[model samples]
Target chain A: MPRTVILGVIGSDAHVVGITILEQALEAAGFDVVNLGVQTSQPEFVAGAQDHGADAVLVSSLYGHAEQDTRGFHHRLTQAGLGDVTTYIGGNLAVGQDDFAETRETFREMGFDRVFDAETEPEEAIAALQQDLEIPLTETDAEEPARATL
Target chain B: MTRDKRLPESELQRIASDLRDDWPTAEAVEFTEAVEYHGTLPAEKRFAEVLETADRPLLQPRAGVPRLRDQIELLEGLRTEGGADLLPTTIDSYTRDNEYAKAQEGLEEARETGEDTLNGFPAVNHGVDGCRELIESVGAPVEVRHGTPDARLLAMITFAGGFQSFEGGPISYNIPYTKRRDLAQTIEQWQFVDRLAGLYTEFGVTINREPFGPLTGTLVPPCIAIAVMVVEGLLSATQGVKSLTLGYGQVGTLVQDVAALRALQSLGDEYLPDDVTVTTVFHEWMGGFPPDEARANGVIGLGGATAAIAKPDKVITKSPQEFRGVPTMEANAAGLRTTRQLIDMLLEQDVQIDGIDAEQEFIERSTRALLDTILERGEGDVARGTIRAFETGEFDVPFAPSESAAGQVLPARDDDGRVRILEFGDLALPDEIREIHRTKLDTRAETEGREPSFKMVADDVDAISEGRLIGRPDGSNPAPSGGDD
Candidate 1:
């Protein structure tokens, strides 16, 4: 079975392009992707994972409010029994160019398994998802896949 | 919401009253007194007249802050330092989502800490008095620019507060700006906004209603953007709005952007009632910007050059700091001046590009296809047709996050760097039009030595930001100087 992954832009940040591209990338890499779009809350993320039996949840934010928006996100996921599902956070995680190393460290401490910067392309995330999920990196299997739903 | 029918007078009043209660500051809205106050403002402060009478493409910058004093100071700097022809008071996101209490908290925090807590001015939190203060302070005409799906309360307050022009419509604001808002609900809500603006026009204030043109602000095909503009324009005219400025965003391709702008104005006039004077606004590249300031300025310069050739009525400027969230006021003014320098140098040169006519013809034909499908779906009612078309995927915006849209259609740049549809989804365009797009994209695929696929679409999305118009594969072309990492 194709591995399932849930993707979304967390909090009030309405930026969707990054996640939209990432969705296409991961789906092309053979993941059964469910994109939650933007302004997605932690509960919504948990519910989406629960509903889809997702293997991973990729959180994206571009408005510099990710740190505040994801304060209790991992705890909520753990409470919801999604602790075993992999979690990834990406995009402009902080307000300023205050070293992405620190930002990545901060989100890693918040319990994300992997973190990506704003400039990180979709391939990098796809590769990381494959590495974390142990999916074999063969030819891209996406054949003009249907638009993602839910 | 059922059909594209005008809201009755009684219904307009009922909703206006209810909207006033969304927040306490809304209590200060007095229609008759507000009309009188609008009469007191000078002609120079009128948005529609100033825009309509302009001899050249006027420059306007997007800017807003939490505090009223700081917002005023910011606008003052843009006006004096940037030489902005028009000014915008972009509303905060909480206000856009109608989260007034949160906006109030942000406003209070900004006031106390002297740091911007909100991304934009929470106009609703400021209420009528505060909006009036902003209008009175800005020397030039100010437009209330926000992406509110339900701008009913905002319209009631901002209009009564003396701002004459407002940006956004049901589809333009909802599809690109948010998720989960029903299209039918927003259409019904924006009807109230247009109806109110029409009422003001009848009272001798020509409020300029501009439909947000840059839906998704990505590689939106020209036909799709222009069709949405005409649909919104027709809807606004139905509500008695007389002065309309349809908008088009720069897509980076010189020929295509110019053609799209012209098509937007022509189609807007052809579709809407003649009594409604139609103008066009050109938004500088709304997609991702190069992280480097120098390269970002190049993007802005190309936008100005296109505006000069297209001769749009107003040009919305983008700051070089766009890649980094909200911009400082100085950077905002600097962007305006940069555009101003480019436009002044080229506006009088009469430079013309080849193939503009053919490109414009194609755009017009495609736009008509979408509009006709929409009208048919509504069964002759534009508003009803719009809602039904979106529901059925007959009309769609690419990269839309809103649940109301199918989001199935995808766009990519052709070999010539012009945006073309990569995925049709359920859009209503004719097979021949689809063939044209397919052929252009196929040409691009041949040049790139790859089959036309989603990979092209993805590459095209980040092309301009990487200092190139087309996303060629690595090793085929080296990254241009100042390309973003």
Candidate 2:
């Protein structure tokens, strides 16, 4: 069975464009995408992932409140019987001037398997997912290597 | 957490006084010019280029005709035979008698003439109506304000929070608050305003929809603030609101320069009503300058503190807890303490105002103090120190995360593929057109009050666009050139 990815905006933040773009990219990359539109909750994300038998749950937040907006999703996923699924988060996560390292750490502690900064390129995220899933990279993926390659 | 040692009382007092004095006068003068400049241009020209060049189709006509017809072979066969002449002589006579051509011509003429009407007015009206509809749909009240000073001040306050964001950007703070959760709270505050309006309407008060903000931040795009106001004036005629109060807070230094101020003043003379009173609120803390220089600029002194500067009647202060999305008990406590100190200073100034009392227990409870240690030290320190402070209970208030409160979470996937948010900045207009309108209106409004005829306003705006002005006088001279360009 093809691995499915559940993706969506998880709060009252209605920033739809970023999520829409990501969904398109993921689908083009051959991932069966379960896109929950804006204003989604943690439970909703978990439920969608479970229903779709998602291999991973990906989250995006542009509204700098991602820190407070998010919770222990890994634990929630485990409770929902999907602890094996990879969890990913990216965007302008915290509000104000905070260290990205500490922010990433905090999110990691709260159950995110991976955290990307606000400026993290989309290609880097895809690469990370491929690495974690042990999937072979495609030709289009080679065209834009990760930011670290540059 | 380290705190900066307090400056001497005398020095702080002097600085506070200076900031208070300088801030408002500068803001008032700058806003006055912004309103006046905006009013100088003919509304039609203000947005014509945008409409003509707009890539996205804002307007398109749809076809209404239907397809398909019933079979008329039997009737046609009868007509083709001997019955053909018996069908339509009476119908032809009736059709010939009708004067459809003349009526259609008259209607077309009216529409053509209406098409020449001011551009800014229609566009702004559309935008405002759209905004109002959005707000109302979400259960919020719409407040529309007219006149220069009021609009300018309002623009300043709305833009002040993001003053740093506008520098050198094509669009002034082009980013919409819809993306920022903290800024979104300010927008959401309109719901409270709507509730208030409803409460007042029950008392038979004619609740005027005063236009606040250039609120969406896009309220008036950068450089087109004046144009937005002019369009607003035209919109107000139908809206039935007479007076408008313009509020000015911390607008950027460059945008509010002398030239911009003059432009605002000219725009005001052309568009705003005579009775409209402009109020300027200069937050002393905005300008990072010595108190003495700031004082000369008419900044309202809220004691010696910047935060204490007088808040507007409808003040929207961000709760520290709300600022970063999570409630930081220490941050909230600090914010409240700062707010209280500022409020005390404002009360001492004896300024008359009514709204959220800074001293109220709820206000105090809701407000957090200035996390000076965190804010000054920067985000990394704040985030690190915040966690430490929360764990140790070193904060004045204990941390209690709201369980039921909806968290502002990010989506794992974005609809727009791009990680960043899209922004549409300021609207552009020909500089020559703006200048010409400014000169004509400024010359006229200084001498003539509200009595200037609409034709005169239009003529001045036209001449300004044309760069033709005769007898343009010295500074402070209110006379217009009598000669045609």
Candidate 3:
């Protein structure tokens, strides 16, 4: 079976458009996407992942509070016994001009497998996941994958 | 509880004293005097005066640097090279979110790099003196602009530092800029900010406070924007703000933009106390920018022309770098210059006003109705009424993250690109006005031969950059819909 990925804009961020765009890009690249939409809770992301046997949890925050919002994101995934799922965090991650290296390190320590920026092309995210998970690059899966609604 | 009253003199002093005690007051005083522009005018220069005196729309651009001295240089460049009528010190993200420790850290980094690492000025770290220095360095009256929900400390520092203008309100600042922040808590903190301005009013310093008018800056209907402005105006007036500038963001259509400005000014006059003076400020497009700099300039030029023909007292300019990142000083200055030159030329042309158009009446009627409902909901107090309205969806913002907001009000552009509320949620608009929106949007949908749905809304979200107003359902997908996110 192809891998399923759960994604959302974490807590109090209503930047729905960016998430919507990412969802389309991921689906076109042949991943079964379970989009939880905006203002999604950490538990919900975990629940969406567990319910769908998802391979990843991608959290997006654009309001510059991603540091605070995603502080316990990975911890919650592990706490919920979904520790093996590959995780990604992206967008305007921090408030000020903190070095991106520091930002990447901070999230890496928090257990995200890969961090994507708004500047990070969707193709890169897809390619990285494919290489990291050893998934087939071709769209060999059936076209009609079930979309899990939150 | 009563709706509005000035802070008691004793409370005001105690609050100011407590606020001062939280920071280094002695150093704060030095920063204020360092400002070369501090009290440079024969009379105290106030933000309201610039708007009131301008025969044509005055231009202001957002510019800030982490270091105080760098910010001073940036503003000077904007004034001399960019011809800014008014100056703004946009606060950094850390300060906006009240992470002063990080802001202080950025301040040091900026000093070392000689390049600001922070997005805006760190007013709190600069203290009263640092803020005053920036205010004085600018030739024109300056305003502190930030998207802060709890702006008390920042307000105290800047106002004492000699900034005579402030932007933001309890509802406007909280609902749009934050998520999960308690509505009542932010409102209470802002009451302190407003009361501080009132103390200045008693001291005879005519300070002006503006409520953010764009609210999420994404396809907000005219009535939704005006209703919030008027409510915030009334809230500030009760706190004894003698001068107020009610602001509105442009919605990319000409007549609708004009009508929104007129309605804001007229409504401010009507709702606020007779003694409180009111002016209108128009914002250029606050949403997404085209990736191309040339196309972005065209978008900005449209805003300038609209401001000119609409005859707003002042206009806020957005830089071409809006799509990429924080604007460079040169880009910021370019925005101001383009606006100033266009407004100057437009002042000569005649776009004579006749009787009230349906757009104006519709906006005015909807605003009045919403305001009345709020007053009724609050049972006379705007503060209480606003809380109740927000809780009940009587006042809701489009695309806002606040749980307090109903979020049911969906907005889509009509054929002409004027934002029309696709769903009113719980708004108390007159039936006739609602019909006007329905017909306008319905006609557009029919022309495109598509059902009015979220797709059109999505397309309209990207319409400006694509060089179209209405997101017509031409076969081309606006980035291909439906990942179902």
lDDT of 1 by residue, B1-485 (tens): 36677889999999988876789988899889999999999988999999999999999999988899999999999999999999999999899889999999999999999988898999988989999999999899999999899999999999999999999999999999888998888889999999999999999988999999999999999999999999999889999999999999999999999999989989988999989999999999999888788888989999988888899999999988887768888899999999999999999997889999899999999999999999988789988899888989999999998889999888989999999998898999999999999999889888987777777887888778777899886645655666444
Model 2 agreement with the true structure over B226-251: per-residue lDDT tens digits: 33233223233222323332222222
Q: Write the per-residue lDDT of candidate 3 for residues B224-276, one digit (tens) a residue.
A: 89999998888888778888888999889888888889888888888888999
Quick one: RMSD of model 3? 6.7
lDDT of 2: 0.34
> Which prediction has the highest DockQ against the true structure?
1
What lDDT does candidate 3 reach at residue A100?
A: 87
The better-scoring model by DockQ among 1 and 2 is: 1
Pairs that clash in candidate 3: B31-B129, B32-B129, B37-B136, B38-B136
Q: Candidate 3 falls in which docking quality class? A: incorrect
TM-scores for all candidates? 0.94, 0.30, 0.82
Model 3 scores a C-alpha lDDT of 0.79
Report lDDT (Cα) of residue B186, candidate 1: 88
| DockQ per candidate | 0.37, 0.03, 0.11
Q: Which candidate, 1 or 3, would have the higher TM-score against the true structure? A: 1
Instruction: Provide the TM-score of the second chain in candidate 3.
Output: 0.93
| Chain A TM-score of each candidate structure, as shown | 0.91, 0.86, 0.88
Q: Counting only residues 3 or more apart in sequence or on different chains, how many pairs clash (N, Cα, C under 3 Å) in candidate 3?
A: 4
